[model samples]
Target: MRRRQFLAGGTTLLATAVAGCGHPSVVLDMDEATAADIANQVSISPEPGSAEYTVVSAAIENASSTRRGRSELFDRTDTVRIGDSFYEVSETPLESSEVTVYEVRLDFDPADSTAEIGEIAYEELPAADRQRLDPIISDDNPPSGDGYDVGIGYGTTQEVGDGSVFVPEQQYDIIVHNGDRYRVGVSTRTTTETEYRYEATAVTSGVDSFADRVRDQYLFTLTGLSEAEREVVEEAIDGGYFQDDEAFRSVTNRIREHEGLDVTDSYGTWLLEYEQVEYLTYVEW
Candidate 1:
């Protein structure tokens, strides 16, 4: 339950409490650009105040539904932040067969020219051992049976009578084990057909917005290529995701370049969230 919770009072009240409460601390959207900007301006000095913030990425998708999922960390908190800012920081296993996906965003302030959005796309990867994921041993894997790491995640398969299940259509069936062996599974559909989600319906959005934009550009880039180039593009998309490797790194890299910056870890941030691991704010400076 150590997750983000936004102050209830309207923006006016919350902003005052955070920015004017006799402290130099600022109230920034849960985004990296905002964090970087604040850090540059005033040296983000943490003083036991909360770095956990919310951004309401999508405005009231459904008032009734929002009320329902509001309490839990998963179930779509809508507004989520990474690391201290929207730019999430994380350490990952070299290769994991199991995968989890967390989509988080980083945003910028309109007035701050240096501020820019950061998009994170993580795939809670499984351990590299193919045998651990072997259909024969899936039941033995720690994540198969019981609890999954993420606060909110669902399963497509189930077990009955302590027996391995059979799947005819699939060359292999995923085994269900119990205990701490679970990981967040992204969309079941192939990474090939991607569905695009924007913050607003002609509405509003940001860093996560940039992530979405870049993803769009990549798909468009892949589509725009000629038949010969399309095959390479398809291969690139098939391998992991444009976000997971150099294929799409430049999409966000240019944002940094235009700002006259050298290199960036923005894409790395996205990879972390994909795991669906829970994190609490911890900043040294």
Candidate 2:
């Protein structure tokens, strides 16, 4: 598959890998802030012999994408450069889903600030290595009748049967502090679900009114609101209290206290239950 196509399938997952004898197996716990930081520094295109290009070359040289699952007997270790610092890198492919989830980890000895990571173009990979990775990254390779056990995320639902499959996308680095050596790496998860669709009651709106803005941005439904409660929400939105986190929390707390409204200050979760739909309404955000 192409590089962009490969990256579009990337998702998040928590996993751990052994760093060999004497070193501890570290958990791959990545938070949003850390992920974003690494992503910002990634070079989609890098000059030859540069740190970014060197790491990509190292990853390809140590490619274990064909490996099926975690095995003590099959583990391989190699070193890659990130600026002036060199890290021990390992590839662990987890067969936890319908698709193989590959985890690439780098152990930063003493944790250098200049150490970074990014993606490499698929065309840049060796012809032989690309062939080996085809089945792992290709959409043509469909899953067997065996189903996935993972649940769907908010705003969408997955269809039954073999129509749904998890596609691995672009790998990103996540830095985790582990004493002297910081464990930094990238792992794949389900980013795009082919069978997922929007919930039916989910509505889309442009920049029309404060209520419309709340529905569009927060996914908050104002359908079953009392007249008094509706007025309070409108007032809060109009006063721009929703723009600030603290103010938004205070407003939501007050509404919950007096109005008894089932609401939250954050986005994603539906305040009121809604039916499922086969598709989402396309809206200009």
Candidate 3:
């Protein structure tokens, strides 16, 4: 895969996929407007302060898919080819460490859409590692799980926003112990005296069911924890903290009290205030 340097205006993006013997390289020609429009459709803007992970995913996908179609993009049925250029744009979310990633792909030619590129297959990563990525896509109603109960809630806490716009936020926490076990907890801030609310449910993804098929996809990142800190987290899990609200809160407080090491880099400052973390959903709806 290769791309020619953008011309003087910075609008032209010409990408070519190198092929062997019988097939000629496929080239995609796109200008800045085309690229930007595709970016918008996919919900990944390179604009500042829009989560660093999203920017990285968008940038990588934009550049690579410009060179060749990522077959994984086809797994989505909503993907469409439209406009005179037959442009195609897509946003695929992934999880890395503490943040969510939105991969954006743009294709210019209709013929290029059906091309199969084996190297870009999602199978490249192990199931567990793959689960770490998320789309950061949100919806008003919680998603349904066949046999597993779905728990949902909104945070009572409000993040200040510009006068004209305000978006309510929600959080969910899910822990997958292994193939057959998982627990979920939901929380939200409230105006009442208690000021917060929570709900939890335990679920079993029956064998060969939807949950079971995705069981191995769960991803966890322990990158920033010290050996002792990691042990503490492991102990919490072993003790079933995630399944109990009180126990989970206790372990959270313990982790926060560790002033000897700064856990902010990997976990984000949000973890410092455990009240703000949610499991399955993003902070804002």
What tens digits encode model 3's per-residue C-alpha lDDT throughout 1-285?
Answer: 212122111111111111222322222221122323322222212334433233233433454221111123322222222211122234453322221212211121122223232212233323422333222112233343443344322222222121111112211122222222222222333232211111111122222232221223321222355555445444432321123234334444444344311123322111121122211100000
lDDT scores of the candidates, listed in order = 0.24, 0.28, 0.25
Worst 10 residues of 1 by lDDT: 276-285
TM-score of each: 0.16, 0.19, 0.14
Worst 10 residues of 2 by lDDT: 276-285
lDDT of 2 at 187: 43
| Superposed Cα deviation of residue 127, candidate 3 (Å) | 34
How close is each model in CA RMSD to the real structure? 25.6, 22.7, 28.2
Pairwise lDDT winner, candidates 1 and 2: 2
Q: Per-residue error at 136 for model 3, in Å?
A: 24
**Candidate 3: lDDT of 272?**
23
